[model samples]
Target: MTNKPDVSVLCFEGHKVRVLQLSGDPWFIAKDVCQALEIVNHRMALKALDHDEKGVNLTYTPGGQQLMRIVSESGFYKLIARSRKASTPNTFAHRFSNWVFREVIPSIRKHGAYGVPWALLHDFTRRSADSVERGSQAGKALVIRKIEKHQLAHEEKHLLDCFQPRLALGGESDAE
Candidate 1:
């Protein structure tokens, strides 16, 4: 696909990996995945992945348009298989893979469909982000006034807020 991929930067244990799900599961930035897996040389790791399993994607970011090397879900598994912690349970690699497979992929497949009108979807996305940022303040005015909901304490609200940092990295439960 020549169209620009919708890239999302996901932080895993402080390492940020970019993902794009256009039709199937999603492709992850090879370099980022390799870094997350603690592989010293991404080029060496990428050389082992099959042709169809790897691809190049063009993504638009605030910095500018850039070409990124991406790996398919299968290629990602290859990288994980090559990881030192692949056979170990509850390792960082395993947890990161689990986070992507269990949490990220499912969510992407559910909401990343292209049926919605582009303009409306774009507006909604922008507004939703703005809402989250503004509502995260002391009073949570949106929830209290607009949604007419219960008042949530700081700790209770922070654990599951839009800007939640814990669950985004290490807190997500791994089924394995």
Candidate 2:
């Protein structure tokens, strides 16, 4: 079994953030954390962490007041997305695929051929879409990967296949 760090909540610059500790387990107050950070909701929390550049800088408004929180899971999740978004999918895929392939896949491996099921993937994909709609480039590649992983053809071909039927119904060629 690979080493899995213990996840917990930590406070940085008055911001309630989650951390992965090597020792004992940690506690989390979802409501308290969200409120302290001044984020509109949990979705906002996910968005902020997803787009962080330098491991998420936690700054305070002079005299060390106010909050900006981030969670460890957010980092892991974003790593998956960043890996997917590079100039070539294969480049990032080789390095970061391990993030998902190592962490998530093993957790639900007991179900056999039907292991993990499509519902979970769908949930992740839906969240990926939400991240993209919220202008999260880190998650944009995740949405693309979600759809690409399921189709037998490449993205452009799949798009053509989808539009072909619509054009045929109107008795018009899709080339237009």
Candidate 3:
């Protein structure tokens, strides 16, 4: 039997970032996230992360089972933080960091899974919560409107909302 990957590909601008849901939160493919953050040597970058922050994931592809390197949310943040250290205050890293912090992560948390339509959730999250409410509901963990209502400070909220990770060898996979 073919095991369908429980992976979701989230596109940030032109970059395709693959996320795998495990435990209660999402784990991102290291290379995909590095590409999005413009980190050139992902290997060197991964080394700087804590042992808990990095690891491997087993996934399926047409060829069969594959081992992919993955990173916990904390690892993801470390990678982004590195970029910030290498850039100016208002550089691309800053803006992209904002988007990930404010939009992407929260969207993933609120939806449980991207239970909504794959192609449309991006637009839905981009638009007002009123519009998302108009769509169907499935495993809706949190309303977008509620996040707005709480208006929690970004870093503090996510740190409390998710985990603080011990995460192996990973190989690159197709964007899927």
Candidate 4:
């Protein structure tokens, strides 16, 4: 198995921000961070901001290799600041900045990974189980309906067969 870099996803207001530790510093995916901050044009925003440019080759499951651009910690801050300035409704930018500064960065510094909350995992599992149960019930109901239809068809055929001899005789004339 190829050893992959230690990467973690931080949930910032329902947005997944991917962070990777490279050379003992936290580097974030430019696109993810930009998206969380509600930046419209990533290329234009990055071009306007003064930030370091770096790339990493990521192995995607079923997609082979992909190149992702990452920004240094300072670069990320610069981008955020730039985005905050450009954003009309600055709530997203503020929230993103607070989340990074208060939760993500501290978690990374202390544990080397952003610890995902257990509640989120538990909720996800419960929902998945409920969905599976509902699907199974629906499938069973469908099968039962099909079986009932088949039995009804069989009964109808039996009734038709019982009258077949009578109908055959009635259609013939003695003079024929």
Candidate 5:
């Protein structure tokens, strides 16, 4: 299995919130959590927080690694409380608070990870498998084209050897 860090994006009422698992605790990306709760000025909002915010390096797909400011679970609830007090409508904050308390936190407590329901996980797995299969097929075609043009038998072996790791992921079968 690929030793990738556990990072997940959750959607709350059309907002994308990014969460990271670090050292056995879940951390929320400050900006993302703020955005989900409709907090306009994240910097100002974070200032009212009683807990010290922390910065950590997280992998950003298609853009390499980035340093992100994050908040602990308690700090996250504190931000929610602050948001609920500050928001004019309060409905969004209430809804978000409910979802986190009823669903998100419970899942984390029980599963040791953000509990993505099985249906969602299954859909994600299916899509990921499709994408990987397509990529592997495309890669195989390109490798074949290159091998044909260069007539390099050893290079073909080396290329196939490089793909071995990906093939081991179980998305695609070995291509001879």
Candidate 6:
């Protein structure tokens, strides 16, 4: 059976970014994009298009002639959704931790921190709490060291909280 479309409505900045599927082509709507960036009018949205490394194409809004750039499906683009909390227990304390760290963190950093729900931070850090609480001094030091080395100072605290780190210790994994 075809799985139901995964959808999420995230309020970024002042906009409700609805991550939805339309015609099997996933799209985040234009109004939502503008809102996420806190651009009140079309001019600001157009200005932001120059920064789109993805060369995202735009579609006109009827009557307004304003365009919304869409990040089309491709190698780098992804669509994700939020689901209900799991009922059955799992070892992990978080759901989709990497995505939250990778995608949400940067966005939150770029935008002001006021609107995002604190629960997002909670969910992201939930899994790592045990590691933080129980790990040896060295282990905890490792977390701090990695944060200091890689992430920006502003991102350090959030990064440490949400860190799931699929990458292995010492920077190389055996599987690779």
User: Which of the two, 3 or 5, has more lDDT?
Assistant: 5
Q: Which consecutive 10 residues in model 5 have the weakest lDDT in total? A: 54-63
Residue range 90-146, candidate 6, lDDT tens digits = 312123233344666576478623232324543545657756676777787989998
4 or 5, greater by TM-score: 4
Model 5, 1-176: lDDT tens per residue? 11234677767776667776766566788888887777889888777776555444454543456767778777888888778533445577667777888898788679766644334554686799999999999999999999787877777888888987777765555443
Cα shift from native, residue 57, model 5 (Å): 2.9
In model 1, what lDDT does residue 112 have? 59
Q: Using Cα atoms with residue i matched to residue i, what is each candidate's TM-score against the true structure? A: 0.53, 0.21, 0.54, 0.61, 0.56, 0.25
Candidate 2 per-residue C-alpha lDDT over 40-60 given as tens digits, one digit per residue, 9 for 90 to 100: 455544565534321222322
lDDT of each: 0.71, 0.42, 0.69, 0.70, 0.71, 0.42
Clashing pairs in 5: none
* Candidate 6 wrong stretches, greater than 4 Å: 1-7, 12-15, 43-101, 104-176
Model 1 misplacement above 4 A: 23-25, 89-91, 105-176
Q: Higher lDDT: candidate 3 or 4?
A: 4
The candidate with the higher lDDT, 2 or 3, is 3
Error of 1 at 70 (Å): 0.7
Candidate 3 structure quality by residue, lDDT tens digits, 52-104: 88888786433556787889889998898788533556655566677788787
Error of 4 at 112 (Å): 3.4
Give the runs in model 4 whose Cα sits over 4 Å from its true position: 1-4, 49-53, 59-62, 85-90, 115-176
**Candidate 5: stretches off by over 4 Å:** 1-4, 85-90, 115-176
Kindly indicate the candidate among 1 and 5 with the higher TM-score. 5
